[model samples]
Target: MTVDRLGYLGFDASDVDAWSRYANNTLGMMTAAKGKDSDRYRLDSRAWRLAVHRGEADDISYAGFEAADAAAFNSTAERLRQMGYQVTNEPDDLKADRGVIDLVSVIDPSGVRIEVYYGATELFEVPFVSPVGVSSFVTGEQGFGHIVLATPDLEKSMEFYVAGLGMELSDIIDWDLGPGGKHKLHFFNCNRRHHSLALLPAPAPKHIHHFMIESASLDDVGRAIDRMERDSRILLTFGRHTNDHMYSFYGITPSGFAVEFGCGPRDVDRSWSVVRYDSISMWGHKFISPE
Candidate 1:
């Protein structure tokens, strides 16, 4: 019942070559091709944090949440079944692909695949080395970073993630100027990371809205923006979020979804009281992509 962190993410994209270039040249992720089609990218010591599998749909394939251990995995599976969700034991072949010891799988209200597991394979043989001259990534107990998912029905999604999954609510943003939009943002945290997952209004492409990766240095973000200008599509202009206080800019990936390269976000804890804000960002984060 205790979901620990936002573990690895598996995404399916048609163009693995494009993803490889963007990950290595721009984001500075340690990259390796998986099999003949898929490619895995590493931001930390973990075998892989993000997997872009070659597929027809350019969308998030599944999200893995780290459970405490074998006991936790069994407890979580039972908990989900008691809640009326179909929790299935992950097959061995899939486990090998995910690099996890054990896990249970379930589909959320929005039909997104969710896995709860422990023992992600950590690579001690080859340490993470960013080819783009960047320093270390902001990971560890926080996991890779936050991922935002779009759902048509917010209440159902909340019931699955918050009530069923038991992820801690970090904050909510009902930002409206006056006649402000009806869209609502719900941020959830597992460990110290401000939000491991966010449930947002589903506009279109009802998959992952974006996933974030934070840099230890602000200069790295600036450098990425410079690199993004030449090769990638810009989604959100440079901005700071009012809730997490993450200074970041959003760039469209080769798969056509956005990734927030951020820095210096405030950490959260049990004492962290959930608050509501009226704005998405404190300074920037303007919508740059075509609507």
Candidate 2:
């Protein structure tokens, strides 16, 4: 699958009001629309980049990867069928809301939901309103953002993402929580924005850790942290990661899940040689939640 970029992501949240507030106040994203089933936020000129839906639980609902073209979209659907995964095309209203020609949905071996789509509609006439005065996110050039999910079947998930979906392994970190504590986490980068997806040491049918959006500068990252603290939403350490060099901190979303606000991620060069490291963090972030 020649996945060029991230299409959009779906989140299941109970408190839509909180989500809307956090998104506008902390994340600096504009609300495109809200409905009975879901709410959409726009990152740029495109219709929407993130969708929040009412669900029984708070977790990542689905991930949408943008295909290079309609051909790729059709091919991905066929490939999913060959792999014995169910696929579905977006309904008419959904297509209009998403601004996509079509969306092909599938569930991986770990039962993670994913969608592949093409032809994103955009309105060049509309000016982008940066919520919270956030200058910009590292999106247009790096894709939308990255997602980290927990999965038990690491090898199988790896095969599906790397071999099947065409993501490259950027780095792998073996984590030791404490004495006799060890865990293996791998990072995969689809575009230049470091790892667009990461897998944690867990079993199948796991919850999402958090998703990241790029900040224009380190100052923005610090500002977000300050805002989160002032607003009583701070969730974790304000530190930098060694892997992608993303200076970030974690905060509680309105949906009751963690959100990573980051900036200045190390962009990868396709021609360069691989540089592997035993650790992913140099300093700052000393906290890791198992929830």
- Clash count of each predicted structure: 0, 3
**lDDT per residue as tens, model 2, 1-291:** 567777678988878777878888878898886644788888787777888887767788888888878787787677767666678876878776667888777786667788888888675677668778777777774677888888878898887777666778888777655663667778887778788888886643336877888878887887888888766466668877877888888887776667888887778786744555666577776564534
Best by lDDT: 1
lDDT of 1 by residue, 209-290 (tens): 8899999999999999999988887788998999999999999998888999999999996578988998889998887746
The CA lDDT of each predicted structure is 0.86, 0.76
Model 2 segments beyond 4 Å from truth? Answer: 203-206, 273-276, 288-291
Q: What count of clashes does model 2 give? A: 3
Q: Model 1 segments beyond 4 Å from truth?
A: 33-37, 175-180, 289-291
Candidate 2 — which pairs collide? 152-202, 152-203, 152-204
Worst-scoring 10-residue span by lDDT in model 2: 271-280
Give per-residue lDDT, candidate 1, residue 163: 70
Error of 2 at 97 (Å): 3.0
